[model samples]
Target: MHGWRIPASVWKWLILLMAGGLAVLVASELHVGLGARLPDGEGSLRVTLEDQLGARPQGLGTHWLTVAALDPRSPLAAAGVRPGERLRFDRPLDRWRRFAPGERVDVTLDSGRSLRLTALPTPVGLADRTDYIGRTLIVFPALLFTLAIGWHQPAQRAYRSLSMMFLAMSAAFFYSFWFGAADGPSALGKLVQLPLNCLAWYFAADFALHYAAQHTGHLRHWLAHAMRFYRPLALASAAYTAWFALGHEAPWLWVPSTLSIGGGALILFLSLVDGWRSGRGDLRQRYRWLVLGLMCGGVPPLLTMLPWLDWETGLGRITVLAYFGGQFLTYCLLGYAVMRYRVFDFYLAVNRVVVFGVVSLLLLCTFGMLQHWVAHHVSAGHSGFGWQLLSDAAPAVLVFLVFNKLHARVEHAVHAVVFRRWAAREAQLREWLAAIVHIRSSDTLVAGLAAALDRFGDHAGSAVYLRLPDGGFALAASATGRFPPRIGPNDPLAVLLRADLAPTRHQLPQDAGVLALPMCHRAQLHGIVLLGARPNGESWRPDEITLLADTASQAGLGLQALRVDELQQAVGSLHAQVRRRSVELQAAAGRRRFGMDALP
Candidate 1:
């Protein structure tokens, strides 16, 4: 049993490289043109078509294009081919037909109008470019996050399931983008690639259920057993979809595929409910965000998949954009949970995300309003290249001028609201922290911490527990009569504080009112701080909790320094004793040699 591990930083770079290469390949395969419209000329016509044939003339097949718009100067316009008219070809209009520019073709309209014209090239439009770019944005981050999870915590079964789900979704995005970008249906691309794309979704659904179940620790045995049959069902559905895509009509495949997706969604919802009901504190909070993220990421895409929605049309394109945006938000939240909540100990990640989001929104809104005002007043009717350049550059300049100040104000506001107490007394807290670090004895360090806590707020009592060599927590300092003399290493409160280094409220034996804060450094439990109820007997506020945690961390550092100093002193004393012993032995040997000489 052998395995290899790669650092997360390296994994990130590799994922970026892979994404860049894939982007380049997809771009190369894409057909570039002036726009979605035909060339503006006498012979050329600008025609828009209804994407669905059912919305057009009854006799027209799905391949027949229904004209939604026609340019006045076009030859087709001269021939009285108007909007609401439908055009049909001798053969089915597929990707191959759509891309072959300048080919002469026979066309018949629904009104019995017929004309011979060269097929206009289907130019890629702004909407098309936006869709492809959006998908790329979504896929890149999602892939990076997935790889990071797998590389950083490969042993975690929940993360492995999540990685697989993300991988399948990424592959599906790639295939969809690849075929969608092609000028025509490259037979190999459409047949083989399309089915594989559809197959990816089934795999994604299965993995999503597995991920949720594993994460919530619910329905473990049943879900694991069900998974054995689910794999075969997923594969069969993919094969059936593939067969159906290859000119075979089978409606039955749709039933199982739909059921699979629906079931996965149900499983996830149930898991969330179970987790929310069974979990506490951070676990509960995590489940809430997971639900939100999944909904934001998954529901929009499902809505867009409604049969009546024509995804190639303008409205459909907007829906797709929304879907991609939702997916991006979803992935961001999920990544934050997995990285910050599950694996990493950094609490500031959430704060940073919030700050960044708020600042970005403010900047965007400000920039947009300024640009609009500038364009209206300064650049109206001045459509020269220089004027256009100035219009484009003004917002950026304005943003640069004000962004730093705005960012600072926004961050300050967020901290003030989120950590009100800490923000208010940060300077004082810093001064105390500095004084605590300079203390060189355990008793002094504990006494200083207790005094600092008292100065910070009105606590009924306070005590500091220093960790003994044998792993017990002994009360080194306390406010005259605040706490007991000692708490054993195996005490419930001691064990809980040691296991989770977060500051939490705990009742001592017989319901003693105390808040226990774990003093830890780099995840090693060093000691515990017990503080009695506030003077007014109020609940602990966020800022107060935050202050306690911060103080505990500082106290841990002070205790560590004290321990190091004690060890250094012991070593010096041992060295001195060894020197004295060496001198006494030398003197004794000299006396023995003198006595022997006298006897001779």
Candidate 2:
């Protein structure tokens, strides 16, 4: 039997199926691993509240805290502790020196209800400091990458969608780092984290589906089609999760988060696998790199989701390092893929992002360290507000000056490294064309054209010869050397150029030589360009020849336009003269009529 050929569209489903299987397998392993690692239920009770326990300001203070919920089976619940009921202590809860587990606590609710219960250990832990650090490292680069892609390749729908996904993830990470700290109020932290958590997974899946459909051309597949609804679904899920967290104080929001995360991962996996299987040569290689990148950056972060892994655990630190390091490597690999394949023309953008990010980060860190040292070691007395302002401004001003000086150099280096030679040639062509459009004077236009050609470095000498009204080609502009004053209409080279209306090589007497490019618009020969040997003394490449021909055509059009404008001006002047003559004749006729009438 011959090898089977899968249609490109089928890859989407295949990837999804495979990804689902892989997710299931991973989830099962994680479940087993977590079960083995998690301690038996500590003396804590899980609870959901029907309504939020509102906070009230203490006497002469703005600080707020509340018994937000109560476990249904807990000792407090047996004593009539309920949601939305404010706790009243005999002395302020804050005033209590210490309360150990099993200590009796008594409180009256706002509704005059009374309760007495034993204190119990709550299943809460301090947020790890390393978690914040790792998240910052991951998110800063991700944000920069997203911004670069969005800014540079907005037209590419896939990239835009991917950027949004990254933005969502970054926001989630930021929220976790900022609000999920141990010092933050537990109820408020959970409220802020809920929607962001949902959004992160939703956008991740959404990005995967979009990536698959766009890059793999798998939109026709049913799964890809179904993914069309994923965005709306994700939004609804996030909204619901937020509402539930705020209103009911429920932990069930994890259901939607899990579904989104699992679905997205599955789709991404399927898409990648399908792309690798179906792609040919360079495309296949690109998919391989992308897969490796995703695995490196993506897997470690996912592993951190295991309930058993806290920041204090050795495995947690390993996962954090892996996550950050993997993501950095992934971005590098993706940037390489972009450069090699010209994906969304992102090479220059990637270079700019990397340079700016690294430089800015270094500058900020150095300034921070210096400020800290100065604050502790240099400042001996209390500095006033003005002095403080100066201290802050100094570092900012220094950084700005240093960045301004280095930015141009960095940009130049980046362009030189990232852009190909042809891109430079194209840029030169555009400059020449722009000059031709903007310069209206015939002399200036011709001079700029010759200068532009010389700057291209393809020719040692160049000249523009425009057709004069006297039926001869007059030298309008010359670069680097003198040229003949005029060429007769019947000259052999001129005849050939005019007839062909194209570039042609001509040999002059005395072994002097040139390439003649006819400048023609609408079959009318406007001018000719006589180009000398290349600066390198080599024959012109085909692309260079094409460039010359195109430029010559444009020059011809510019000449034609100039001639048209001159003719219009002359015609206007002639019309003005004719009007004056007609007025004078009419005045004389009136005088003659008046004289004839008087004589009679």
Candidate 3:
């Protein structure tokens, strides 16, 4: 693979592009207008009704079907008409005429039996298409929010979650458009489309709780525990949606949406309550602000369902808009938390941005291809600008996404390998400098240098040898800080070397190998330090030569102090011995004088 991949910035743009396309599709569908879309009914109770009255019928209320009259011989024949049941037709009759099938009549019959009927020619009324606007407004921004959150704080456990949540919203939008334009009577299609809104609702709640937790540290534990329950809740939501769509049960849809969103809100409430009860003032303050936002963002959608709201003139659409707005606002706060708190870090954010962007772009391109194929091949020459718009955007979006991923990966790799290693070495060198704080004598200097050498063990041993005035050198300290075998004038470079002389380095061979560094003090050469191969026979780094030279200079200054102390101690000892010898001679003289006087 080429080194350059995608970066996070590009990934975000990709999501935007996709969401924009989805929004466009939704807009186009809306512009087609409700009058041109909804099946014939102006204050008429004509729902496109189909009753496939099998023993176990599925997708019964999914699409628009003409309700046929009940067959008297059918099992549900005795029952009367029921709600959502209507008369059917065999073929396209005249405008506004009562629909009729040739031979068979199918009816709901108040007992919920179904039969096939003829198609009808009916005019479509104005459908309140305001819901499309809700989808459009939410889809792109939510996608951008999700991409942003995931890219910057991917490891925070919220990243995957929020991305999936927005993706679910996108999925819902796609289904809505697909169902809106479906040509045939599709029970399966409606069955599939029916649950998308509910699922999107669940994802919305999930994304919200996670995002809130990210901001309010007090809520994190509760949110984490709440997240653990998501799998079960998701399964339940799916099950409920299936039951509602397939079983034609209203309560099934109601149960999951209420339970999932309600449960999330309850969890938030408890977290807020606990935060308030805590005596810590700062904790209470931050949490209260957060809780306020959550309520504002979360509660309205559920409350809008009440009958006092007069929901028919597109209040359902308003509810969604409230939901999206609240979620988007929370997304902004969560991003602020990430930046202010450094919740995860830059790399994770970058990684997410790149991956999400590239994937989103690819998906957008794929959708464009599918749309083109459908428009050209399946639709058979019927053309629309929507397909053209999506296709034109595909190539640019793909290129932008791919480059973003590449940039992020390359930067992360280089930082890890090169920059971090260099930083570590520099830190070690600083530590060695700190060790030389209180140096009273040369021994301390030697010991410090030995410790530093241990850090570079690939080199076998180090030795410090001071030069004598006579031009010979004596070993002062070794890697062990012990005096080694003295090198008089017999060493390999003994003839070529000088001490107190030229400020230069010279290597000399002993019974072992030769690696030498010259010690210079104030531009004066003091001695040469030799380091032998390590016991493991490993080679030292080239930088070690410079490091050794620096250490030797410090060691040279220490050696001067040692030499002075040694000379002073030797002079004092000689004086004391002379005094004792003089005293002995005096005693001998006194005894000789006494002997001579006695003889006289």
* TM-score per model over all chains: 0.56, 0.43, 0.37
- In model 1, the runs with Cα more than 4 Å from the true position are 1-21, 26-118, 121-137, 171-218, 242-252, 307-322, 335-431, 437-463, 466-485, 489-527, 530-600
Q: Write the residue-wise lDDT of candidate 1 on 23-81 in tens digits.
A: 44434333222121112111124555665322333222133566778766555676778
lDDT of 2 by residue, 40-134 (tens): 11123233322211111121121112456766777757766656555544423221112234446555566667666565654223233344444
Using TM-score as the measure, what is the rank order of every candidate, best first?
A: 1, 2, 3
What C-alpha RMSD separates each model from the true structure?
11.5, 19.4, 20.6
Off by over 4 Å in 3: 1-127, 151-153, 172-231, 246-253, 269-297, 313-600
Count of clashes, each model: 0, 1, 29
Which one is best on TM-score?
1
Sorted on lDDT, highest at the top, how do the candidates line up?
1, 2, 3
lDDT of 3 by residue, 33-132 (tens): 2222322221212333443222112322222234444444332233444435534322211111222212232333233445443333333222233343
| lDDT for predicted candidate 3 compared with the true structure | 0.48
Total residue pair clashes for candidate 3: 29
